[model samples]
Target: MKRRWIPGCFAALLAFAATAALAASDDPSYGIIAKHKANSAVRISDEGHRIVYGSPKTPVAVEAFYPLRAGGEGHEWVFEYGYNLVTAFPDKVRFVAYDIATPRGGEVWQERGLTCGAFLINGKREVTVNGKKLSFLRSTTMSGWTFAQLKAAVAAEIARPRPARAAAPKKPARPAKQTVIHVTVPCGLAGPYGEIVHLFRARHPEIRVTTAANGIVAMLNQLRDNKMTSDVFIALGLRELDDPAAQKRLVSGSITPIATIPLALVVPKANPAGIHNLEDLTSPKARTVLTYTPNLSGGYGARQALQEAGLWDRINSKIVTPKVPDQCKQMLKTGKGQAAIIYSTCLKESYLPDKPPVIEKDLKVAQMIPQNLYSPVVIGGAVVKTSKHPAAAKTFIDFLRSEAAMKVWLDWGFTRLPGA
Candidate 1:
């Protein structure tokens, strides 16, 4: 599915190789491979043809399609930006791409940035992943160096000793040990990081709170192993907090609910599939999109809503379960899914400041599922007992319940917990 395929910058890059170069129904026929060599962009198509481009912003040719193997999801037609090139990966050409992220699935989500090469996929996306992606049914979900990071690194690998250039002035070392506390949450809940951290910093300037959103499973594994990428774990589900607390991975009684998120029935722009409500998914015309199985973090609420509606058995087979929520959105944005079940906060996550989220042009909330359909998802967290910064962790965790932080959370579409 879409790897938060909201293409804008390099930050959101991540996903896997699709079958063949692309799906049969897609256009452009072949994706033009791009490379940086000798200060020029070399664009090469599948037919062994090549084009030398001088400008960094030249339009790279591309073909867009979905692999039938990716749960039979549809192709995303990239806009004029033509990020559709990402659909045709596995070209075996390694380049210093993305900012570099790794691993997938943990008590927190640790996902490989992406197996394919899509452009800056965060703001004003070039293209989105709107299909069901190949889930890691295999043992290894994500591992190893999937992409290059620097041209110098690649040159070093080739044993090419070039003339040395003068080194630039060294920058200052990390400022005298700020009490940096890393907080990991699902991407949808990441929107408030700036505001919350800002307010916290206003009073606790010595403490630095860094927040990132990913699958909770990926982060937890790191916590369990004491890797401690996170000092504070704010998750989309309470199970994440409870399970670790049960194992004594966290400080005693530190686990607590931070907020609750309601569910939404999301549809693509213009309601192309004619899905006006949840029940419409059962019809031949609708593709009820879902997050991958083990739905703890991805399609957790969608599965619940359908089951609560007594439509699970009837609509289960027709669902396309992507590996993540972004993938589900991608399927819809690229013209695949009829409806996606997701947290209402997800709308806030993808909302553009220029327009309201409910009126999002690419995807719209078709229905706001009643709370009676399912229990509100409890997003909670705890201070890691094994943390390198325990005091700072507790400080930030405590700040989450503060009046200031609660305002940011609510602004980001979360409901404040009782007595928070």
Candidate 2:
């Protein structure tokens, strides 16, 4: 009977060893080993000796791979392949190199951005804690990093000591207070400033803000028609602010300017039509020009420029009107005309492939003639007088003017107003 029991124990020991091996196998090999920088929230991967950041734009050379032990549910080595080089450690040993791999083999979806973190089979990313993985994970949101860096960060975390746990404190009798705010913002400038809004939301999760990108006139009409929506109104023209009807509809002391935008001339690159100055727009050679329909801001700017140039008739003949700024941009991109008179901001936002052909080069920002005719496009925010959440709207507006909040808007090429 004792001999039989010995055999049973031997079998049990073998089974335990196999299970351990399988768990260990879940960890990666020859992949991201570690990250060096803390403030640099970039993800990384390994390509043999080279470490690559997730973004294709910024690749740096990696010096070494320091592997770490994987515990609990284990980590998956998902290689978003790209020819990007990244450094493992910045201070001790900063190795900056480039990734030379071709685009054919790399993951495409993450070309825009990438990060590596605890993930579950249900398609939710989680946060790794102790030996166990926890749920309710916050998504890793970031910019300015390539794919290779993401992989290296995972490896580095494994090698480093786990973050020290803090002692659980006694529960407070009162719950932490949070402020909720609501705001209405313009849709046109919304996309460029999304990061700013997101940052503000992170701080004041209670704030329920909304945005609409419709033209200014349309927004005012909505308010007047009483089909109004949103806690705040953001638009371009100042006339709305001074209007008796609009003033009556707006909450007192809520109207304020947030940013100042300058007018600019948008033309195709090289200006083949010899349209160097505003006067050139009237020359006989100038056959076609891009502008928004008479109703839009771009069209108004074009009209003003022609008037200043003293050749409204010459420029008018070449008017190629479009309904929207993006539409006019598209027309210019396709070489539909030589140039389009548009806002400088629109020109800055237009996307053209890197190193485009000469014909595409014609699309660009042009200098204005004498006096420059700088049109001050003011973007303002106001609380709707009829909004049910008037207090919330005020809180949201305050968040937009916060020091932490202004940085986001500044990044989008907006100059904050004196009070904003």
Candidate 3:
């Protein structure tokens, strides 16, 4: 899918904003909300509404809904919450159902709903679990939680009488067992590279993976900034076998090239630019130009190729550098740019049933300038030194290169690496 950021009409924009506000209202306990605070590593508002705050992926401000009972009452009460997903990204909330019994065996109760990682509580009831005091006024439950069994333990704590403590403050409840491995994959909606990483995590239960498609360059820059630790980098072959800095960061000889992505120059299938080869771009007759943004690592590779051939000056004269591949394709289709350079895989994908805004054949993969330095950019994965699970990281990387995983990458516009 070619990514085009078509500015929404004013009415549509208003509707979206209104929807986001309503979504935020689902959990209303307001206070200093800590991140990764509980066993789930999720922060909650000081006055527990049972609302779990924080994004499963880089949580902005707890958006998933968790309606809590009034005043944290332990007595049975109905709770519900609704979540509005942002259109820019896919929002998937896993729901978990919990059944709790008070220590006195007063009554059997159940809580259920869908949650990203935490829930909201709004009532007056207080429960002590693992020593720390927790309050639940309004209770909201989520669906699809893997640790459904933990809720009962929580309820028992709530039902028991308050335990007396010495002069010392109660010790904080130990954080959840077996910390999850956070793997953020940067791939666009049209690309399947991110999905491949998810599969790798599934096969290895000990590890937990989270994926985000921040475009290739943004993803790399994120790693560069150290905001997040990517246990493994998964993207085009060029990202792995080509980048000098990327190569330097790898454990010596740990670079595993699993697939290849061909580079192609494209224009709206209309061929408005009449772009032919390296020489035509410099003719000064070309109108608007399109190419990967310099900020992206892959864009850097493309620019390097241009500089080596002495076409940088000519190309830079008429350039449109979009942040991601999808945006690059959109520029041409919407007539924003007369021509664009993108991955050949995008062209093949354009042939799919609901083709992107432009036809594939109209955009030709400009012949690789001085084909000697030009080769399909190999895409693959590697274990990062910052990863806590070195063994698991290496295992995941090896799995990506394995025959079973290669088939998936091969189908997703990646080619076999040289000498693989």
Candidate 4:
């Protein structure tokens, strides 16, 4: 998640602030930041205060990301983004820091421009000190940044007045009606689920979503045993819905097409194996990991592609099938496993066709499995039969097929069914 995403476009912790008459006794209260328009700027005081955004649609979340001194020397930095508290120093740096939630609307957030409280939004105020550019964030969706860049930004933002502070945005609260729905999707979609589910909640605030990302097989086992419960099941492949185990738990008529994803052969950015094509996987030198669980769908797709290429027998020996090959991107990056075949959209270069390529820094697609090589897998969703919120569950399912959800799916690299 290393971010080269917003080079020219920077989202500062700036929301529009109303001037307070130098509050009596330096009362610390930051102004709300939701840029109604550009040309407006915020005046940031050194006082560490919670910056509030006044939009009713935006939840009144009080997540504290305010800057704090790490040591007596003030040499280290501590940033709390939601539940995760990150303590960082210049000497040693951890690669990934920010956990991005879904952005509101790209066009809207950008157009409103920068506001000032912790950082500014919707405006461009790139502060360059000692030739190092200050890059902090790109909306709520963050990317990995180097320590130097982070240090520079921290120094610049917190420099003159006081300390560098990062204020995290909170979503608006839900209604008291208390109609909640639990959603289960594959682990691969967890990241996108943040954005997609956010969109769903925005449109339907009355329905609370508690999401769980697990493999279809695990879901099946849990469902049959009554250990797991989900109002909605967004599955990887249509075949999962057809399984007897799944069918018993899901309402047959409630199932619907979500998206179609083709398999991809991915490798680390280093490309140590020098793999360029599927046929290379047959070489004894290569070690590829295929998902052993067809219940997961990724493994099923990989096996299907290899069989279609007539390389299943030849490369079968080279494949390393772990019991739960859930982390393909990690395996490729960590050298735990050299190569893997997973959903092409699992980690993408771009979420939208028109957007800049926010290539996943650590990995890349060595080769995309030809659509003709095997039958492409279709992602589907259905309502659980045992759900108490059946009507609400059905409503959520219907939302998945809506134009809004389709946009989310397409932006994340899923293709719509040809006819539907």
- Candidate 1 residues 1-420, lDDT tens each? 355555533342322234333443242323222222322343422211112122233222122111111111221222211322222222322221211112112211112222122222111112212232211110111111112222122222234343665696785564476876766555455446445665787888788665544444445655666654567777777755545433477778777677777778888668867887878888888745655444463355667778989888988887787644456666666666677777666655422222223324467788888777765678777876767988888888788777888887787777876444
Q: Write the per-residue lDDT of candidate 2 for residues 124-159, one digit (tens) a residue.
A: 222344464433111122112234334444444435
Best by lDDT: 4
Give each model a TM-score: 0.57, 0.49, 0.49, 0.57
lDDT of 3 by residue, 1-420 (tens): 223444446667889988986755442321112212322333233222233333344322222221122211121222122222111212322221121111111011111121112332221123345665542222222121222222433335334455553495675553355434443443332234444545665676565443322345545544454533556666554443355655555456666666666555665555656777656777555676676665443465567667777878867767667654456765666677766666666654411112222225445566543434454466666766677776666777787677877776676655677777
In candidate 3 the C-alpha lDDT for residue 356 amounts to 28
Model 2 has an lDDT value of: 0.48
Model 4 ranges off by over 4 Å: 1-178, 215-217, 349-358
- Please list the Cα RMSD from the true structure of every candidate, rounded to 1 decimal place: 15.2, 19.0, 19.2, 17.0
**In model 3, which regions exceed 4 Å deviation?**
1-180, 194-208, 235-254, 276-279, 283-285, 293-297, 304-316, 323-326, 348-376
The local distance difference test score of each candidate is 0.50, 0.48, 0.45, 0.53
Q: Where does candidate 4 have its weakest 10-residue lDDT segment?
A: 67-76
lDDT of 3 at 321: 77
What candidate 2 gets wrong by more than 4 Å, as runs, is 1-184, 212-221, 239-248, 293-298, 350-362, 368-372, 398-406, 416-420
Q: Which of 1 and 4 is ahead in lDDT?
A: 4
Give the candidates in order of lDDT, highest first: 4, 1, 2, 3
Please write out the lDDT profile of model 4 over residues 1-420, one tens digit for every residue: 337646423433121122233332132111111121121322212221222222222211212221111000110132222111112222122111110111121112222221111222113234466775543432222234344554455444433463454685675665878797777655455445556666787888888776544445555556665544567878777876777866788887888877788778888788788877888887665866554455556677788889999988987776766654444455566687677887777665322222344557777788989888876688778888878797888888777768888887787787787567
